[model samples]
Target: MKAVVVEAFGPADQLAVVERPDPEPRHGQVVIAVEAAGVGLVDILQRRGEFGFSEPGFIPGVEVAGRVQKVGEGVDRGLIGQRVFAQGSGGYAEQFVADAAGLVALPDPLSARNAVALGVNALVAHFSLRRAQVRPGEHVLVRGASGGIGLLAVKMALQLGATVTAVTRSTAADRLAELGIQNIVRRDRETEPAGPFDAVIDPVGGAAVPALLGRLAPNGRYVLNGGAAGFPPPEFGMALVQTFFNSLTFSTFSLNSVPAGEAGAAARAIFADAVRGALVPVVGPVFRLTEAAKAHLALEGGDAFGKIVLEP
Candidate 1:
């Protein structure tokens, strides 16, 4: 088996492609013959040593879509050859092992490529909308609406029958328009868009929170889960003050806190909606497994429009 190894961990070029031992499932685990894997900002950060705890010489990738080749102790043999998506470390390889508890079988209608596209980003958006309790006819604002997760939220909010206000750069207008999202704002503009939105889905957090709060309806909910602009801004007190003054709701979403089984269930639900033509994932540039380093470069340079995938 071959894998992308973060050897020295400084730049994208440091991600080396090398032969590695094929992974075997331990008790209660499953090994996948990976078809595709998703590249993310976290992968880039790990490549750059920004994640201080990530040491060198580790295979990195959190989510992947493939077929189950083998099942371990206490696992059903019937699961073998099932097309599944699982979350775990070492996804950037031909063979990856993960907990069987985290695996979800994909219906025949979905492909491995599309499954990887709709992986984590879509899950985060789904959980965010649920936390915000977005309802039909409500007006929702989505900041960073052009990014992978932000764009997903825009489409989901629309499906929920909410009026979506997408805040993105002018470059994204044509793309958003193609998605039927007509209400778009230019992020470079100094002025905020007019809104007393029923909910605000903010992926770009930091000093922008206070301004986003102003857009929400009096009793509206604001779901903060991403840090596209950056995290832990100099101050976070404004949300506290605003939440106190208004009968507003502040909520959060994290895959880490939620159990793996729960995440897999939600993903299957979303995939069913996808198969029904209710939701579609936007896939951008793709890389071969050996080109993992270049994929990280494109992501670091902000070139990925929706989801970046690696085909093994």
Candidate 2:
């Protein structure tokens, strides 16, 4: 087996692909022969020693889509050779162990590559939308709308019949337009979208928070998910004060903070949307497993247009 190891967790070079012995399944576990792995900015932040609790020398992928090669005790033998998406550690390799209970069975219409692209990203989008109780005809605002999770939020918002305005870079204008996003605000060239937005899905936290908060419609909700913007806005005090009179809701969410069943349902919904053609996971650049360093840099530099996948 081979794994992309975060050797010392400092720079791009610190992330290297190295040969390792294959892992065997333990009780209630399954070993997946990883077909493709999703590359996310959180992975980059982990490589940079800025995200999660992982230390150096850990393999750095959070989600993978592939075939089950072996099953452990109490696991069904029939699951062997099945195509599935499973949440697991060490996904940046050819093989990794996943608990059988957490696996999402992939449908025939969804390819392994697309499953990896959509897996965690879509799960987050689905959960976020559900949390916001988004209504049809609501005005929705999606921050970082060009990134992997952001793109999915856009798709889900559109599917919900919300009028969505995407906040992204001017470079992403054409791609956003191609996706049927008519209104866009570039982070560099323009001001944030002035909403009266009924729901604001902000995965990009930071100096933008207060501005986005101010634009929210009275009684509107802003759900903060990720902080890819690095630094957060120093307006928590004001955000608290304004919420009182505006009757607004400024909330935050994490899939990890939820119960196992709720999280699993979200993951299952991601694939179901793909199978029904309601959403298409946008896959950006593909990298060989060995090219994890380049993949990390591309994602961190905002060069990856959609979910980037690394194939082993």
Candidate number achieving the greatest TM-score relative to the actual structure: 2
Assess every candidate by TM-score. Answer: 0.94, 0.96
**Which residue pairs does candidate 2 place in steric collision?**
206-232, 206-233
- What C-alpha lDDT do the candidate models reach, one value each? 0.85, 0.86
RMSD of each: 1.8, 1.4
Candidate 2 wrong stretches, greater than 4 Å: none
Find the number of clashing residue pairs for candidate 1: 0
Q: Quote the lDDT for 26 in model 2.
A: 98
Question: Cα lDDT for residue 287, model 2?
Answer: 95
Give the CA lDDT, 0 to 100, for residue 300 in model 2.
76
Instruction: Write model 1 residue lDDT over 1-312, tens digit each, in one string.
Output: 989999887888888999987777889999999999999766776777776335799988889999999899999999999999888888899999989888888989999989988888899899899989999999999987877789899999999999999988777777889989999888776466878899989887877787777667788898887766676454565765756766888776676777777888899998998899889988878999999988888876664678889998
Weakest ten-residue segment in model 2 by summed lDDT: 231-240
- Error (Å) of candidate 1 at residue 65 is 0.5
Candidate 1 lDDT at 127 equals: 88
Candidate 2 vs. true structure, TM-score: 0.96
For 238-278, candidate 2 gives per-residue lDDT tens digits of 86576678888888877777776777777777678778887
Candidate 1, run of 10 with poorest lDDT: 231-240
